[model samples]
Target: MASKVIQALYNDDDVLMHAVKKVRAEHHHIEEVYTPFPVHGLDKAMGLADTRIAITSFLYGCLGLTVAVVMMNYIMIEDWPQDIGGKPSFSYLENMPAFVPIMFELTVFFAAHLMVITFYLRSRMWPFKKAENPDKRTTDDHFLMEIGLHDNENELADLLWETGAVEVKVTEKES
Candidate 1:
């Protein structure tokens, strides 16, 4: 369904940031923001909570380390022995020096790859997914803020204009 929204366009990031803060100060809900580049402290200005992706990344790294250890122990120590430098230890701890590089590589690999996947999924982005940007100009040098339209359409537009928005208009958004 289509919903009414107030689209505020700003030519500068600073203006957009101030407009966001003003809109929020008035207790207006911000539906979305489209910016050409990342705005510093925008999440805080939007009153969003801190993300927990770092925790997931740490877990992924741990999993990778476990997989590497198990695979190496079964392969080089139990299944088929490898005598590096003509010395056969037959113990994972003894052969740990040689396994350090593999362990480190796997840990970083899992953390990086899994974090990327998690980010994509969490952001609702995937292969062949359509873009959600409301305006094409947002990809360039403009910032657009979409505020859901309530009974205060004119009030919001006036407030946004006062906050230095270059343009403000009401439009129907696809929900």
Candidate 2:
């Protein structure tokens, strides 16, 4: 049989934080927290490590810039060089400003597409992927804290209620 997990639902992040602080002070184990929008300093309170998405985004942007420069250089200078209005084609280095538009366009294109793809993959939000939200209201106006109870489940629920939980429910793990 799967063990049950208790979730305390709150309307405000402040209330949630108070509850987390209280529970942690009492050495209760917290499983996860869900919020509709990011609550500043909540991750620190929960002792979560910093996310690496910023570094990943920077790397992806650099890749896009490199691809743009290489592709533009290859096409305009090597593959099929063309001159317009008596402008030199063999030596684009002298007219580097002319390639700026193409470079910017390609950089934006690649960075946008790749960043979106990366975010989706990292969040496990592929096309047609069903979100595992336990309550529909959680996506709108509710903040939820999921705690695991090794013992004293009833007392914990009472504490959560005292700390401003709008509702408390126990959910059994799916087998």
Candidate 3:
């Protein structure tokens, strides 16, 4: 069976937020939303699950810290010890001050870079990928909300219009 969606266009973020609340209150299923800027509390309004990506970032940082510790210990204490500033690189604990900067830098680098890669993969935002934006205006100044249509075209369109949608249109969705 073919699917359908109702696209609602709003000029302002406030109106879009209001419309989302109204649609959700009426038990309508919203499929997606596009906004030029992030709308505060939109996810909560949409009833979306809280993201779990922060846990991955913490793990990535731990991996980087572990790598830095092992690498520094091997290079300075075991592989080739150096004597500089009257302090020999003979013990990791004794020369801990010198390794602090490298450890901090590596932890931050791993967290930031790995988090970005994970986000890109999770969102499928690969380089040169075609955008799924329904309208060009949505990328600029307009906000768009796509609601799943379940034999409620007229009812949903009327509700959207009442909620201050500038335009409402129904279209077939590809499986």
Candidate 4:
């Protein structure tokens, strides 16, 4: 089905934030917002749920730690024991101090890389993906708010303008 939507553009993040609040206060549903940079508090203002990336990051870190421990244990204890600085590779527990830095580095590396990959996958963003922003200006300096139409295009446009939108246009979109 085809639906009409209003795209409102704003010059400043502060104005966009206020406009979002005003629009939500009137009980209108917002489709999406595009900004050149991250707008702090915009997620809450848009009523989006909290993200679960932190939990995934912790899981990734644990996986990295496990890999590092198993790898070090096999290489140092069972495969080929080496003596460095008069310290013998007899047991993992006894020589754990030397492995602390490696464990920490692996944990951080896994968490950072995996979290980025997870974010990209969860957001449906990938290499060579087509751009979705309707206005090119939004990628540069402007902020855009899209609201689905319920046959009140004029009212919504006026409200957007009053709430500090620089430009408002109604367009039909296919779902």
Instruction: Return the top candidate by TM-score.
Output: 1
Best by lDDT: 4
| Residue 116 shift from truth in candidate 3, angstroms | 0.9
TM-score of 3: 0.95
State the lDDT of candidate 2 residue by residue for 18-131, as single tens digits: 888888888887888989999888888887789887777777778877887888788888888888667788876854788888777777777788888888898889888887
TM-score for each of the candidates: 0.95, 0.84, 0.95, 0.93
**Clashing pairs counted in every model:** 0, 0, 0, 0
Per residue, candidate 1 scores C-alpha lDDT tens digits across 58-170 of: 99999999999999999999998977797565778988988899999999999999999999999999999988898899999999999998788888888988999888999
CA deviation > 4 Å runs, candidate 4: none
CA shift of 117, model 4, Å: 0.7
True lDDT of residue 31, candidate 2:
82
Residue-level lDDT for 128 in candidate 4: 100
Tens-digit lDDT track of model 4 for 38-76: 999999999999999999999999999999999999999
User: For candidate 1, what is the TM-score?
Assistant: 0.95
What Cα-based lDDT does every candidate model obtain? 0.92, 0.84, 0.92, 0.95
Residue 41 of model 4, lDDT score: 99
In model 1, the worst 10-residue window by lDDT is: 82-91
TM-score of 2: 0.84
Better of 1 and 3 by TM-score: 1
